[model samples]
Target chain A: MTDEQRLYSIWVYLQAEPLFWLTLTIGAYLVGDFCYRRSNLFPLFNPVALSIIIVSGVLLIFDIQYERYFEGAKFIHFLLGPATVSLAIPIYQKWALIKSNAMPIISAVLLGSVFAILITYLLALAFSLEREIVLSLLPRSVTAPIAMGISELIGGIPSLTAIITIITGIIGAAFGTFTLDLLRVKKMSARGFGIGLASHGIGTARAMSRDKTAGVFAAVAMGLSGVVTALIVPLIIFLLKI
Target chain B: MLESIFLIFLFQLVGEMIQKFFELTIPGPVIGLVLLLVALLLFGKYSTSVKTRLEKGLTTTAEYLLGHLPLLFVPIGVGVVMHISFLENRLLAVLFVIFSATVLSIGFTAFVMEKLQNLGNQNDG
Candidate 1:
């Protein structure tokens, strides 16, 4: 065989390996991270968004199926489970603060989650979007992995839910502080908890950069809201009978 | 680090089993999180030093994972390309819904939280 044919054979062999795609996934994210940093960590320059665009473009160009790409990338995806379990560490660490602020945190999360779900549902309905689309949007305020699971359980497209969740997070990260400032909500705890309740991890990251107190509250809010949304969403769906 | 990861996975495995047995809607990882939180709370009440050590190990691993948490979602995000058709005509509507809901929800929560906190302070005073 000619050198060109030999190179083609090697390419075909590498494509079948999980390591190749896993490396590509990480490499693509690094590039996205570099750009994100270069832009001063702007919320709009979201690393996940950039990485998705790059990876998707590559997959499209190569005609590689998403399932094939996922086979390798699942290694990274699997960490989401353990990472979630680790959330308990921070919650445990901040147990005292949580206990003291229990009333406000609990009330705010419950109100915020219900408002988010209800508003999204009403708007989607008014726009006359598809039913499944509306269901996917219901959990858009939650973290991506949990939101995606909720979407799947509720008969919506999981991938679509992931995108919607990310978009919602970006919006929260971008405009959360600004909105809070406009309302004259100066307390760092309030600001952080509000953003976290509405936006999840991305918003928490943004809150962290602003203040340590805000970061802790944001993290706790994100964790609490995730659980609350999961429980209440099904209940709401059943009650509304939609 | 390995031990921390093993413990996390063990919790998740048990969480998964619980979910399966109860036929609940809650996901395994989330259930794992609550279980771990309870375990830590209980353990902390009994032993501070050992709890601190365990927490330190878990913190290092958790932070490492969460620091790059955004990266973990890339694969699923890329899958959006597959569902591009679903989003094509409704992109504007989706964007509007997400934007408005997020902004309003954030504002409402912050306002209420701030008010409640102030009320608590007044009572204390």
Candidate 2:
């Protein structure tokens, strides 16, 4: 069938039975993740990297529209909130360690958040962009969904915010650890905290792959950074009167 | 596994409660996490069997989901196709901000955290 026809059929089916896209997302995720673990290609074969590739192809081949896919795929998206929440279990298990390291965590997040915003704004201004556009670029280091909302609040573009969020996540995943090692960062807690503060979910995922301790710290940093940035970024924006 | 599921459910419920009552922008998982941490601290040590099972299930689930998590952005990619107009208008600005912010985030995070660790050690010494 032509792509349009296929999309139409999928849409009709979706109207009646809506679980298809969710299943596809999960299946694609599983297959891609398995291959990534097997292949060990850091940048190229990353599961999120691969899944996006495979799923995109499937959607094209099936002539499925993005909206149709999103209808069911939201199941996976909805789980994102709880999945992030679930990190609490591990965090709870390691509360003592976290408590001991709390100072470093808070300090790292504060410094990291400031650095992220300052650098983004500075670079954007250097490039000679207008004010609103720069503000839109501010939240790129945060998660995409959150970034989108923040961008809107600050009168920036949501679509642009999403793109920036993804780019930030990928770059952090690819180069975060290399830089960590270059700096001779030895403590798993420090490494994880830095990654989480910078990359959010993507960084947390990378940290988990390294070790459980790293993952636990990354979770703490990611959660706290999100909270801090959500409040702090807007406040900074408000205070700057920009 | 069952306990983890139950715990996660309870945690999720509490998260919803906080979000609804306080209208907190923080996601539910985060609140659930804070709650779970309090519970664990209050209870102290738990039976290992349930904990292990839950961890096992969570491990596989987290591993599977996170690995391919980025692919979930594909639909968003197609968004660029639609927003091609915005792209052409601010292409340089967008690329510059994303690329720089990304590199900066990694660099700044490493720098600050390392400094904090050093400061932490110096104080202890």
Residue-level lDDT of model 1, residues A47-75, one tens digit each, is 67778888989899999998988988899
- Model 2 chain B lDDT-worst window of ten: B75-84
Q: Where is model 1 chain B poorest over a 10-residue stretch in terms of lDDT?
A: B116-125
- For residue A230, give model 1's deviation from the true position in Å: 4.7
> Runs in model 2 with CA error above 4 Å?
A1-23, A34-39, A144-146, A238-241, B45-88, B122-125
Question: lDDT (CA) for every model shown?
Answer: 0.83, 0.70
Q: Candidate 2 chain A, which ten residues in sequence have the lowest lDDT sum? A: A41-50
In candidate 1, which residue pairs get closer than 3 Å at backbone N, Cα or C atoms, i.e. clash?
Answer: none
Error of 1 at B36 (Å): 1.2
Best-matching candidate per DockQ:
1
Model 2 C-alpha lDDT per residue in residues B1-72, reported as the tens digit of each score: 455566677787888798779866665667777887677666556667765676677555555544444544
- Could you tell me which residue pairs clash in candidate 2? A52-B71, A85-B29
Tell me how many residue pairs clash in candidate 2: 2
